[model samples]
Target: MNWCTRCVLPDTRPGIVLDAAGVCSACRAHGTRDEAVDWAARAAAFGELVERTRALDRRWDCVIPVSGGKDSTWQVVTCLEHGLHPLAVTWRTPGRTPLGQQNLDNLISLGVDHVDFTCSPLVERRFLLASLDRFGTTAIPMHLALFNVPLTVAARYDVPLVVWGENSAAEYVGDTAATHRLDAEWVRRYGAVHGTTAADWVSDELTERDLAPYFGPTDAELEAKGIEAVFLGEYLRWDPEMTARVAAEHGFRARDEGPRTGVYAHADIDDDFISIHHHLKWPKFGFTRSFDNLSLEIRNGRLTRDEAIARLRELGDETPYDDIAKFSAYVGIGTDDFFARAERWRNPDVWTRRDDGVWTIEGFLVDDWPWS
Candidate 1:
């Protein structure tokens, strides 16, 4: 439960490495970018990639997977700015917020051809519930669809390139080697699926046919089609605040209230279940969306350790009771059952219950903040 000395990230976060100097690997990785990256050369390489892909005989030059979030809007706009014809693809979440729908419509108004893919909600709900019961997350199916559907469309449409956003390994967890590219192996290992394939989820109630949409292209299939995927962040400096501001100028709307767990005013608004999914992580890992956002701000030089810790204390725990009722019903569970499952997943090693029935974690750097 130890925390990074330089940022708000906790050591409990999986795959995180803290150096002898006490800076988290993510911070160390950002330092490398500041000191060593050549943005101009990366941008040139991106331009060349676009040119090469556009030269292919397909009607669309590339596929851009989108969720109408700020990052996705930025991706679509970036492709358009580079004179590349990108077909925007969205795998519709179970609960689409009005604001999310509005922003998506606005993105479509930007003149890019868009496709919204939706699987059978009945099957999706079953998978969602199964994931929740087994992994304490309702996002597994969504993650699988997000990663697979775009590739499915690209293959069907004969597009040879798919442009993705930042490499999570490089930007979030500090695997610099993966910063330059994203492949199927990387997607399964680090992306939403996290090595759990759709086939692994098949059961008596859920058949292989019902899970077909979650199956991404095989490596051989991708190679046969000459398809490639690259991260846009590698070509440009990735600043979330800057991207959100730019997206706002193009009609992207921020949430009226900030998200249930994160400081960002305009992220993960497409689904109500997102907050619940993130909240579920707290019991297992002893951190939440607030920690994630604050760590990013610290790395980007927007907040000091004290400031970030103070803000986290003010925000408090981000349990999404507000949306729990609706979300539980959506997944065919009762609110009591939802709470029971959430409590069941709380790792005893990371949490302790007080006499008053309040739960807390120790070893968080925030507890040792100088001002606190």
Candidate 2:
């Protein structure tokens, strides 16, 4: 697999492009921002958006999709600081941890009306198992609900704006097509829902009514209502550490146990099952959440590529064994069967079985990778 010379990311990752200089597209995109982002101008633009939305004289100025994570807290704080009344909305994950609930309550205490939108547990279970069985991901249902519910709320309430934390396409994949505005096309291409909508999942087991929450107002409907969805990261510089610090100042707590999915002690802590989604990237893409986190650190000058690679080596075989067990029980599937399903989706191009009956990635970035 070809690797980025500048960072640790591989071209094997979807939407990652390695240019002739051996720099990945994400690095190239970040470089442009480092050189060209005029924070003053961006902030002015955001201020204008706030003023324009406020002129509408709506009950709520915006809808902020939140998970009580650091980024969510940061978004809430930023929006409130701008004098925008935001209604924080959460697509309540079935696997939400106790810490998640506490953090969420803390977010609400920061002074914003909140909605904890929960899909029927039965529907979530069926959809999660279906996604795992078919697409090798347990996150499609989560993404669908997370992306949709906020838009639905915006439409229902006639809120003129939806404030999302980051433009993930620009931040992670470096898609040139990424923009500050989010529309239906962008969600289908970059939302990580496999380009399928809630309608695509209809079956004898799940009816149209069962998946109602997953269907947001259509783009045409939203357009007719003059609602706009935008990324807050576009206006302000986004740094995980910075956001974590901001969140901590506002009572957002990190996992006391330590980092769950990646190197961040503050991230992915709200949902227990989210780690399973990140861990699955190992067999399928020959990388883990550490790769993504470390790559970002490399971009931010926090770690050299060599140092990040060493850290990845030290983080060896980051299989979320406990998360897998938790997800298996939640979905009412045996652990053995769950792993069998995961292993079936392992990318053959990135992995090969060794003579000792262990799988290994040939020419892995780390010379002494622990395949066992």
Candidate 3:
């Protein structure tokens, strides 16, 4: 597979462009939009949002869901500086990486009060396993960590307004999903299912027959409670790299301890893995490492077209088999047949059909987990 000549993303991605010089359309599109955004104006707009939200109640003025990633850190700092007494909320997931832990600590050190929301370790483990079993991903906790608990906590505290760092599709990923993206919908669907993810993993333990009292959403909740969720990045000029630099200046250090090729996520933050998982799942989707390396090259500015191709050829056939096993064990499945089932989910075209008739994936799908 070739990286889009325009932005360094892969050409296989539908709607992405590939030019002769090996740039992708995402890059070109971003270039166009970047020129139009008045970042200071957007920040002014954010201040207005803060003011309007604060005027809504005497309850905790605002709630900022934070994982201490650069964007979250920036949001919290902005909230605190605005003199809004914000409640920092986080969902502690299993395998919270070392850097993630530090980011959380830093948030505490910054003197904002926070609620540490966590699940039983066993429950977290089981969920990871279940995520692997059901969705082929063990990092499902990271995906769910940002949602659910916040609203549940909001109801308890009666905190009506919540600020989030950014919306993936609208702000950073691209604008295809932007026109109709609604903030209220983001609030409702954070924990259930997303536009891009499956719903069964988190709710699997609850039997449909028994979940009558807990159906996903109740319209009455939104109509009366004034529960408002806002996306900070959409109306603002935002760049992850720029945010990272700002975060570093504010004492947010890189979790220098994790993987280089794959993002070693901060202990509990959600940003890195969401990007990395795409790479893990890409091979399963028939795209190769071309898509993975290209993004980095775009970010770092070293990704030549030829270099991307060579790297894909060199890296395409790897998988995370050990991660799959650990994820399997965490969820309590020990059968060899399960791995076989997982193997079947691999990128159907690139995964191997072994001599024994069972399928084999790039060893990286869940392979070579140093933690295990």
What is the descending lDDT order?
2, 1, 3
Candidate 1 local lDDT, 1-372, one digit each (tens): 778898888887766889898889998989788678889998999999988887885899889999898999999999999888889999998788888899999988987999999999899989988888888777789888998999999888888999998788888888887636666678776875657988899999899999999988876888799988788998888888988988998989998877645888888787877888788878888888888888899988999988998998787657788778879888788999999988888889888777777776766555742221
- The global C-alpha lDDT for each of the candidates, from Candidate 1 onward, is 0.84, 0.92, 0.56
Best TM-score among the predictions, by candidate number = 2
What value does the lDDT take at residue 202 in candidate 2?
A: 92
TM-score of each: 0.96, 0.98, 0.72
Clashes of 2: 0
Instruction: For model 3, give the 10-residue run with minimal summed lDDT.
Output: 210-219
- The stretch of ten residues in a row with the least summed lDDT in candidate 1 is 363-372
lDDT of 2 by residue, 1-372 (tens): 889999999988878999999999999999888677788899999999999999999999999999999999999999999999999999999889999999999999999999999899988999999999888899899999999999999999999999998888998998746767888888898998989999999999989999999888899999999999999998888989999999999999999988988998899999989999998888889888889999999999999999998999888888888988999998899999999999989999999998889998888999998778
Residue-level lDDT tens digits of model 3 in 1-372: 554544435455544555577666566556566576677887787788778877876568767788777888877776778778788888765445566778778876786789877666555655555555566554455555456566556656777777777665543244435532234355344332333232344365734332221222233574467766666676555556666776777788775544333432222243333333444454455453345435545545656556655555545444545544554454566647555655555666455666777545444322332211
| Better TM-score candidate (1, 3) | 1
**Model 3 lDDT vs. the true structure?**
0.56
